[model samples]
Target chain A: MARLEETTADGRTLMRQTPASAEAQTANATLARKMRRRGEESRFWWLVPTIYIIFLMLPIYWLVNMSFKTNQEILGAFSLWPRNPTIANYMVIFTDPSWYKGYINSIIYVVMNTVISVTVALPAAYAFSRYRFLGDKHLFFWLLTNRMAPPAVFALPFFQLYSAFGLIDTHIAVALAHCLFNVPLAVWILEGFMSGVPKEIDETAYIDGYSFPRFFLRIFMPLIASGIGVACFFCFMFSWVELLIARTLTTTAAKPIAAIMTRTVSASGLDWGVLAAAGVLTILPGALVIWFVRNYIAKGFALGRV
Target chain B: MERTWNNKAWFMVLPVLLLVAFSAIIPLMTVVNYSVQDTFGNNDFFWAGSEWFDEILHSDRFWEAMGRNLVFSAIILIIEIPLGIFIALNMPKKGWGVPVCLVLMALPLLIPWNVVGTIWQVFGRVDIGLLGYSLRALGFNYNYVNDPFDAWITVIVMDVWHWTSLVVLLCYAGLVSIPDAYYQAAKIDGASRWAIFRYIQLPKMNRVLLIAVLLRFMDSFMIYTEPFVVTGGGPGNTTTFLSIDLVKLAIGEFNLGEAAAMSIVYFLIIMLLSWVFYTVMTAYDAEQ
Candidate 1:
C-alpha cells in the first residue's frame, strides 16, 4: 500500500512540472525579444542628436565663412566656401588701434565686474543659504527686480547719473554699472548651490574650533568653487556683450567692442569685412572663458552636492 | 550649534548694495528728475509737472510702440521656449558627442548680440547672404531691407537663432539632472513614450521652463541692439519696439521729458511682470 502511494505522488509532480517549465521558457524568450527591440530603438536615437548638432552648427559655420571672405566676395552671390579666402580682414582688425583698444577696455571692465560681483555675491549667497534674516525672501526678490529692469529704461538715467558724478568714460563706471544685473544673478546662482551643502559640514568645522570666516573661506569656498567659477563666467560674458549701458556710459575711453562695431556703419556704407572680423574677435574672449568653465557649468547647476 | 544672528553679515552685503545704489538708485533719481522736468538744451531745465507723463500716456505713438513690444515679446516667448525644450531634449547626453554638441550649441550664445545681428544682416542680404540668395534662387521674393514684412521676419528669426540657445542650455541642464531610475520605473510599468515625456520630462522641466520664459520675455522686450543694428528700426518704424522708440524720443528727437516718462512706465511694466513671474514660480516651487 505504501509503494502504491509513492508512485501516484511522483506521477502528479511530473504532470505539474511539464507545463510550468514550458511557461518559464516562453517568458524568457519574450523578455529577450523585447530587449532586442529596445536596443534597436536606441540605435535610432542617434538621429535626434545628429540633427540637433547640425542645426546648431550651421549658423556658426556661416559666420566663420563670412569672417574669412572679403567685402566684395561677401556682397557677391552665395558661395559654399570663400572663393578667395584671405586673412586680410583679420589683419585689419589686429592692426587697428581702435579695434584692439576695444578689446583691452572690454577685458579690463569685464574682469573688474566679475571680481566685484563674485566677491560681493559670495557672502550674500552664503547668508541667504545658511541663515534666515528679516525680510530675507523679500530682499532676494528685490535684488532680482534689478535684473528685470530694462536696460533701455536705464540708458538715459545711467548716462545722466554717471555724467553728474563724473564717473562717465571710466572703466570703473561700466564695471560698477554692470553690477546692477550681475551681482543679483551671481548671488542667486551661488545661493542655490550653497543651500545644497549639508549643514553638518558647517557644524563639523565649528567643532574643530574654526572661526566662521576662516571656515567659510577655507572650507566652504572650496566646496562651492564650481559655483563661483560659473557665476564669474556669466558676469564676464554679460559685461562683455552688454552695449547699451557701455555705449551710453563711455564715449571714448571705455568704449566696448560692440560700441566700436557700430561705428563701422558710416556714410561710406558698412565695412563688412572689418565688421565681420571684429565680430569674430569679439567672440574669442567669451569662447575662451566659457571653454575654461565648461566643466564647472554642469557641476555648478548641480547645486554643489554632486 | 550656536545660531547667533550676526548683524555683521550685513557688512558682507554692503559692497553690493553700495554698487547697486551707485548705479541703479542714482540713475533712477535722475530719471525721476528728468520725468518731472523739461530740458531744452545746455542742461537747463523747467518743472514740467505731469505734462510729459500725460503726453506720453496719451500719445498714440507710445501706445503703439508698447503694443509692438508686447506682441514681439509674446511671439519670442512662444517660439523660443518650446523650440528650445525640443532641441534640449534631443541633445546628446553622453560620450564624445557631448562636448561637440555643447560647443556647437554654445557658439551662437558666445557671439555678441550686435555681431549676431551683423551675421544675420549679411546672411539675409539678397545678393551675398546665403539665406536670401538661396530663397531668391528658389524663386521667392525675399528682401528684408525694403519690405517691412520681410524685415520683421528677419529680425524675429535672428532673435530666435541668437537666443534660443540660451533656453536650450537651461532646459538641457534641467533635463539631464533627472535621475535614470525614474525612466527605468516608467519602462517597467509599460508606460508609452508620450506618457514618459508628459508625466516625467515635462514636470521635471517646469522650473527651468519658468526661468526660460521669464528671461526670454524680459530680454526680448528690452531687445534693442540687434534690431537697431539689423534694420535701424526699419523701413519706417515697423520693427521699432518700445526701447527703439524710447531711444528715438530721447536721443533722436531730443524729447527728454517724454522719454523719461515713457521709460518710467516701461520700467514699471517690466518690474511688475517680472515680480509676478517670480512670485508665481516661487509659489509653484514651494508647493512642489
Candidate 2:
C-alpha cells in the first residue's frame, strides 16, 4: 500500500521530463501561479489547529488553575486564573505517604510493564516480519483481539486468577495484567516497523556469521531504533493511562494513582484543589515522556505503524 | 517481503503466547466455566447449560446497554475521524510548529483515563466549572447531573476533546509520508484541492486511518472510566454502556453467572465488529 504513492510519483517524474508541446510550458507557469495563490489563501488553515489546541488546553488549564487554589478560592468564585494561589493542595499529595505511594506504584508498574512488553515483543515481532510460521496470521490476529478486549470481562476473572496465585496487591500483578493489552500493541507496532526494514540486512548479517541474538541487538535493533522508541512510548502510554485492570488487580499496596484518586474522592468530601493538583501531577510523567519522544512519535508513526 | 517457512519461529512467539494464555485464556476459561453453570453465595455449583446466556439475551437491560454502546461509538467516530483529519491537514508541515502542535495535542492521550473524566466532571459543574458557568451566564440551563440529554452531550464533548488528537496524530503521520511529488503532479494536472486530497492524501492515509478507526471503535465501545466518572451512567441508567453495566453486574451485584454471560456477549460483539472492520479495510487496501 505504501508503495503506491512512490510508484505513481516516479511515473509522474518520468512524464515531466518528456514535455508534450510548446503550450505545455505556458500551462506549467500558470499552474505554478495558481499553486502559489492557493498556498497564500490556505494560510487561514493554521487557525484550525490553533483553535483546536486551545480547546484541548482549556479543561487542562482549568485543572491546573484549580490545583493552585485552596478550597476557599475554588468555592468563592469562578475565576479563569486563581486569585489567591497556594501550594497547600499539592502539599497534601506530596507529604502524605498514602497519596504519594500511588504515584510510586503507578510508575513502578508502568515501567515494569513497558520493559516486559517490549522485551518479549521484540523477538516475536522479528519472527513475524522475517519468517512465515505456521498459523502466524491467526496468531497475530488472536494477539490483537487481546488488545481489543474490554477490561471489564477480564477484571473479575483477573482478580480471581491473580488471587489464586497470591499475586494480588503486588506491582507485578498489575504489570503483567497490563501486558494482556500492551504486549499485543507492542507486537503490532514493532512488526510494522520491522517489516519496513529491508530483508537483505538480515541475510547479510547471517552471512557475516552474526548469531541471531547478536544480529538482533547489534544490527537489526539499531536499524529500527526509532521503531523501538515508538513501541515503548505506546506501551507506557497504555499501561499508564489504563485503570480498570490495574484497579481490579490491586486493592491498596499496588493501587494505581487513578484508583487512589477515586478512593479519595469517595472516602472524603470533594477537595477539588487537591484532586486537581493530583491530576496535574499525574499528567507530568506522561507529558515528560511525550516530550522526550515527541519527534520519534511524529516521524516513526509516519511509517503507518499506528 | 518474502519469508521462508520456519516452524521454529514459534519459539520466538512462545513467550507472548504463554503470557497471553496465562493472562487471557485462563481468565476466559474461568468466565466460560461461570457462564455454563450456577453458583450460590459459597462456591456451590449446579449444572446449567447456557442458562445465563439465555437470560442475558432476553433482558431489555442488556440490549439497552448494548444499544447505548453502539450509539456512543458511532457518535465519537463520526466526529473524531473527520475533525482529526481536518486538524492534521492544517498542522504545519515543518519547523517549530510541528513539535509544538504535536506535544500539545498528545497531552490528553497520556493522562490517566479517569482523570480525563474528572477534568470534564469538574469542568462542567454548574457551580464552579468554566464551561458550565459560562453557559449559565448566557441563560442556558446546563446541568449534566440532572438532565440526561445534558449528560450525554457532556460525555460526547469530553470524549471528542480527549480523543480527537489521536486521530489528528495518526492522520498527520500518513499525510507526512506523502511525497511532495504527488502534490506537484496534481498541480501540473490542474487538479482541484479536493481532488488532490481524494486521490493522493486519502489513499496514503488508508492504513493509519484503519488503525485509528479500529482503536477508537474498540475503546469507545468498551468505554467505562470516563463516562462512569462523569455521569456515573446516570441521572438514571440513561448513559450506561455495556462496560459500565457489566462492571455493575459483575462487581457491584456480584451476580457472577449472569455477568459472566453478559461479558461473553459483550466481548463477542466487539470481536465480531472488529473482525468486520479489519476485513473490510484490508480488502479495500488490497484493491488500492
- What lDDT tens digits, residue by residue, belong to model 1 across residues B160-257? 88888777777776676665445545667887767777998788878777777877888898898899988988888889999989988887887888
Residue by residue across A145-204, what tens digits does model 2's lDDT show? 888899999999999999999999999999999999989888977887788788998999
What lDDT does candidate 1 reach at residue B180? 48
Give a tens-digit lDDT track for model 1, residues A1-306.
Answer: 122223332333333344457785565445534633542356566676567566655656677788788887877646878898888988987888888888899889989999999998898888877775666777777788887787888888888777778999999989988999988878877887777577799989999999989999999998877677788887887788788888889989889888888876643455677777787788777677677665445333322212
For model 2, the stretches where C-alpha displacement exceeds 4 angstroms are: A1-40, A296-306, B281-288
- The two-chain DockQ for each candidate, comma-separated, is 0.37, 0.57
TM-scores for all predictions:
0.89, 0.93
Largest DockQ belongs to which candidate? 2
Best by lDDT: 2
- How well does candidate 1 reproduce the true complex, by DockQ? 0.37
